[model samples]
Target: MKLFYSPFHTFVHKVLVTAHECGHWERLTRVATFPFKNNQGEDCGDTYDISAINPLDKVPTLVTDTGQPVFGSQAICEYLDATSRARRMYPAPGPKRWDALSRLSLCDTIFESTVQMVMEQWKPQDQWNMGLFTWLWPKFNAGLDSLERGAERGWDDFDVGHASMLHAISYLGFRAEFYEAKDPVYPHYNWREGRPALAAWFDTAIQRPSVASHYNQPFTSDSSAEACQAAVRECIALRAAHGQ
Candidate 1:
């Protein structure tokens, strides 16, 4: 399989966590995409060559050995669950499944809101929109509060939902400086305060091998991308050495 992603893309990292948790981290070729800007520093093409497969031209796009394309974190992560024989995160239809899916929705909602805010920040000050903060900012905080309240259930097993939450929370701290910038509309609250259960849960869960491997490095162009390339290279070498 071949996957196109940007290390700073929180959504893309969800797929990475899914792959790692499924014990197939070394099975795919990880390709880095310049989603923001190319070497020229010009505005990026919304649909780089990846657009050929995904019209959105988004990262976290995957192409399986059979040449089937899977785009978006949900499709990619669920695809991994369907194809792999390892423990499945998508529990068989039950209350647990519904609960997990609900959490996934809340977490991804927060992720999307943050993506919008960050993208808006990329624009000049004059073009800023007040509605984003008026509407989206509160919701993002509410979602985090929801997760913190459910800390016990949120980080229980590191399933697909857990992967979603992990990616979301990690990015908040990872991009702390950006989020903390002088944007009155943007939120700069302490996420760990008054949430000992969730804080403790994340403190431990973030150390898992899947997370520590990809996210431990600075999430910059050279650092994170280089780390991902190295992981893929190592995975390939291991597979080759084992004659698989």
Candidate 2:
């Protein structure tokens, strides 16, 4: 399969982490796509016109060997788990599978909310809406608190769900300052301050070769998805040079 990959995109990072967990990271052919200014004067990243493969023109699109195109991050992660030589990320049909799926959904939802809220910050002052601030941010915090509680249960064993949460936490840290979030809600958004268990787990999660090697872009206010695409391309070159 070929993966339209990005290094700083939380969703793409999520699927990459899942692929590594399934022990099949090397199977994918990575394609780099940077965001560009569109006629609408908005930031758009579908330089590949991914819409030809995925009507949504989104990143992390996977074109399977059978010539089937799969878009969206969760769908790609599930696909990776399903086709992997080892059935490690997703459990077989059963209650355990249901539980894992639910956890995966929660992590993805949190990650999605953060992305939405952060994107909203990109609009001009006149276009910004306080209603989103009142609604979306609270939802994001609820997800964080939910994960905090889940962390109490421990997150050492790497699974798709664990990868999900780790990406959410790390992505928030990576992009927090880029938004206009203020105290109490974001307030530097030091997610580790009150969440001990999650913090401890993150300490380990970030060290994983899969996490560390695939994602190492220091937080930058590039304000364009192109930076993410560049980071992924750079990582690919580095990995190839090292024979990884």
Best by TM-score: 1
Candidate 1 whole-model C-alpha lDDT, 0 to 1? 0.71
Each prediction's Cα lDDT score? Answer: 0.71, 0.67
Candidate 2 regions exceeding 4 Å error are: 9-12, 35-46, 180-185, 217-244
Clash totals, every prediction: 0, 1
lDDT of 2 by residue, 1-244 (tens): 6677454543228787777777777776666643223333444434334455667667778766655677898899888988887657876688667766777888787777777766666777567666766776677777777777877976545778777777777777867656635422455667777788778877877777677646764433443446545544454455456555
TM-score quality measure for candidate 2: 0.78
Clashing pairs in 1: none
Over 4 Å off, model 1: 9-12, 38-48, 152-156, 218-244
Q: What's the lDDT for residue 124 in model 2?
A: 74
Query: lDDT by residue for model 1 over 1-244, one digit each (tens)?
Result: 8777876643227788788777677886667765555323444333234555667857778877655668898999899888875678787798779878988888888877777777887778778786886787678777877887788555446678888888787767756666666465645656687778888988887777778767755444333444544544544565456554
Clashes of 1: 0
Query: Each candidate's TM vs. the true structure?
Result: 0.81, 0.78
